[model samples]
Target: MNKNFNVIAASMIAYFAYRELPSDRLCRSAGIDKGSMFEDATMISEEKIRNLWVNAVKLSNDLLFGLHFGESLQLSALGIVGELIKTSRDVGTAITAAANLISTITPLFRMEMCSDEIHFVIKLLPTERYDHNDPVCGQIRDFLTAFTIHELDGLTLKKIRPVSVIYPADKSNVPEYERVLRCKPSIGDHVGITFEIQDWDMPIITSNYELQQLLLQSNATVKDRMSSEVSFKNKVTNYMLSNAYLGLPSIEQLSSNFNISSRTLQRKLSVENSNFQQITDNVLKRLAISYLKEGSHTLKEIAYMLGYNDPSAFSRAFKKWTGFPPATYQRNEEH
Candidate 1:
C-alpha cells in the first residue's frame, strides 16, 4: 500500500538530526533529498522514512532520538493542517480535528480520542499494517506522541503531560524519556497517549474562528479528494476491519455495503488481481495475528473472535497460513 507522509515530517527529522551529523550524509542515509523535502505540497514514502529514523538513531546514537525530534517541532510543521489546528477555538477542537485530518496528510493513519473519566485518550491507529516490520518504527511512534503533546502544551498555554503512554516499544525507565514525554513508554496494542481532561477545554492562544472555518473547509476538500486515491481493495478491507465488531460480512453483504452487486465487486477486484475470498482471508489472517501478538486472549477466545467454533480448527488454519501454530508464533515474537 504505498503509505506516504508529508514531506515536512522528513524535513523536520533532517533539520534536527543533522544538527549532530552532516546534512548530506543524513539525507543520503535517509534516502531523502535536502532540497526536495522543503518543497510545498510534496510527500515522502514510508520506506524512506523508516530509513530516516533507523539512520538518525544509529548515527546520532540517541536512544530517545524520536522523542527529541518530536519535541522540537511546533504545530505549524503539520503541512496542510498546521494553520487549521493553530486557529482552532479550543484545545479539544484542535486535537479532534487533527486526529480526523491526519488522513489528509498521511492517508493511512488516524487517531481515536475518547473521554475516559477525568482524562482524554488519544490512540494512533494506522490503517495499513504492511510497514510494521521496520525495526525503528518505535522511534516514529515516539515522535508522533511527543509531537502532539508539544503542540497541545503550546496551544493551551499549560503544560499537558500525558498521564500514560501506549507506545510500540517495551517499557523503560529512561529518565530522558520521562523528561521529554513527561511519562515513560509502555507497550500496548496501539499507539496511545493520555492527558488530563482539564486541558481539553482550554482555549487555544491562536484561535481565529473565521480563518479556522475556511481552513476546515479546505481540509475537507483535500480529504475527499484523497479518498479517491485509495484502492478499492483497501477500502473493502478497511471497511471489514472497521466493522468486524459486527462480524465479518459475507461477499454479497460486503458488496451490498459498498452499494454494488457481487459480480461488479468481483470484477473491480479482478482488476486489482484480487477476489472477495482473498480479501476475506486477508482480513482473517490480520485479525488472527493481531490477537495472537497482543497475547491477551486464549486460543478458544481468538477462534470465537475469528468466527470459528473449535479451537483446533483455528489452530490448524493458523498452522496452514504459517509454518507454526498461533501459540508458537506468539512465543517467538515475545522472545
Candidate 2:
C-alpha cells in the first residue's frame, strides 16, 4: 500500500508557525504540496510529517520549538477526538477515549495509560521507530505533555499539574522544561508524565454520557469504514506503527492477526509487488530520516530504535539507503 499517514490539519498548521515562514514555503521545503496539509481529512506520507518537525526546528533554529508549538495548541484543534473527549463522563473516561482513538487523530505514535498505588502515568511512545535522544523526539514529548495537561485543565476547570515528567533524552534547556511542564522533568529511559492518583477520578465539568455514547457510535462506524477500505498492506503497516513501541512484529505475528498462513500472506504481498521486508525497510528509513534531521540523537540511540543491536550495522544500512552517513545527513539538514 502507499506510505501514507493521517494527522490533524490544525496540528500541522500550528507546528508550521514555529518560524513564521509562509505556509507555501514551509510546505514546499518539507516536500508537501501547497494547501495539501490544510485540507480537512487529508493523509500525507509519514516522511513528510516527520519532515515538518525537522524543518520547523531547522527554520526556526529553536530547540524548544515543539514545546512552544504544543503550548499554542487549542483544545478545539483536536477536532473529533477533542469533541469525544469533551463529552466524556469524567477525566478518566476522557483520557481512556483519547488513548483508544489517538491513532485516528495522529497515526505517528501511541499513547498508553497506566496506574500504580499513588500515581497515574501516561506514556507516549512512537508507533514508528525513532531515537528517544533526538531533540525532535524530546520536542514531541514536550508538545504532547503540555497539550494534554492544558486540555485536561481546561476540561476540569482546575489546575492540573503532573507530579513528575520523565523524558528519555539527556537533559537540555532544564529551566524551559520545568517552566512548560510546571515541574522539574527527570531524564531517564522512560518517557511519560505522572499525575497524583486523585486526578484520575476527577469529574470533567462538561461530562455528558449520552453525547459520549452517540459520538462513540459514530466513531465506531468511521473506524470500521477505514479498516474495510484500506489494503492489507496498509492494515499491516498501521498495526506495526501503533505497536512499534513493543518492537517490530514478526511474520508469524502479522499472519496471525489476519488469520492467514505466513506463506499465504507472503504470496498476497508478492502479488502487490511488495513484501514484508520492503515495508519494514520503508518504515525504518522514514524514521531514520526523521531522527537524523532532528540532529539530537546519537547514532547508537537511533540504531537501537531501528532494532539494530549494533550501531555499525545501522550505519551501514543507513548509508545504503541515503548515500551519506547519518551524521553527514544530519549536518546537511541542520544547515
Candidate 3:
C-alpha cells in the first residue's frame, strides 16, 4: 500500500484564498472530497496532491500561479513557520528551524540548509521516493521557493533579500515571478536561494526567548518520540501491540517480519537493553491491565485472549505481572 503523507491543508486553503478560486471545484477536479481537503485532513495521497496542482493551473490558466499564491500566503497563516518566527532569536535560526520542521514532517520536498563564512543557503530538494517528471512536483517546487522567500522577508521586517537565486531548469520570465523573486535567477539543476551571512543574523523584532525555549522543549519531545520508533526494541514492542489481537507474535514471527534470524533478533534486542521475553511480558502486562479495566471479558476469556492454555495459567502470570490475580484486579478496577 502506498503511504499517505502529512501536508499543511491550510497552505492549500491559502492557495484558493490567493487565486480567489473555489477550492471545492479544484479539490473535486483532483478526485478529492472538498469537505476534508481544506478543513480537517492533513494526510493526502501523492496522486491527489499532484492532481490539485495540475487542476489549479488548468482552471486558473496561470503557469506562475504558485508564485502568486505563495506571495499571498501570510506568515501567521503558517502554523509551523509562525511558531518558528516568534520563537526564534534571529532570521537564520527562524529559517533553519522552519526548514527542518518541513523536511522532518513531510515527504513531498525536503528543505535543506547550509551556511558558509559569508552566506547561508536553503534548497528545496526532491526526496528519493518522488517522481520528478510529475508536473505537480514542479509546480509545488515553485510554490515552496516563492513561499520561503516571502516568509523570510515578512519575518525579517523586509531587511534582507537573497544574494543569489538558483532555479531549476524550468525558467519563467513571467512578470509576477520576477516581481516576487526580485533577483535574476540563474538556471541550475537545483532550486535554492542564498542570503548574506550578516542578513541571516538580523534579529526577529517579535521573537521571544522564553517561547523559543518552550518550543525547544516541545520539539525535543517530538524528536524523542520519533527516535523511539527508530529503536529496534520499540519497533518490536509496537509490532506486538498492534498484532496482539491475533495473539501476540512470537519472537520467531517478529524476526521473520524483520527479515532476520531469531537468534540475531535476540542479540539486537539485547543490545537495546531488552530481550524478547521481557518485551512480551511488558506488552501482555499492559494489555492485561487494559482488558481488566474495561471489564468486558471473564477471566477464562481473558486467559484465552492472552493465548494461555487455561485460566489458571493466565491468573498466575497476571499475578506476577501486577501482584494481583486477574479476578481481583478486574474486581478492584470495577469498584
TM-score for each prediction? 0.53, 0.54, 0.54
Estimate, for each residue in 5-45, the C-alpha lDDT of model 1 and write its tens digit. 54444544433422324445666887876556546645677
Model 2 CA lDDT for position 148: 76
Collision count for each candidate, in order: 0, 0, 0
Steric clash pairs (candidate 3): none
lDDT of 3 by residue, 1-335 (tens): 12212234435533453333465677668786644533443457766766777877887776666665555343323345657755788887887777776654346688888889999888888888557777666676777787788666446534256888888745555444555676878888878888888877888756222322322332222213222125667656654553343246667556644445799889988998999999999988877776666655667756765677678988999899889988888888778
Which one wins by lDDT: 2 or 3? 3
Give lDDT tens digits, candidate 2, residues 181-221. Answer: 77888887656889999999998755322222322332222
Every candidate's lDDT: 0.63, 0.62, 0.63
Determine which window of 10 residues in candidate 1 has minimal summed lDDT: 217-226
Instruction: Pull out the clashing pairs in model 1.
Output: none
Report the Cα lDDT for residue 214, model 1.
27
**Residue 306 of candidate 2: its Cα lDDT?**
62
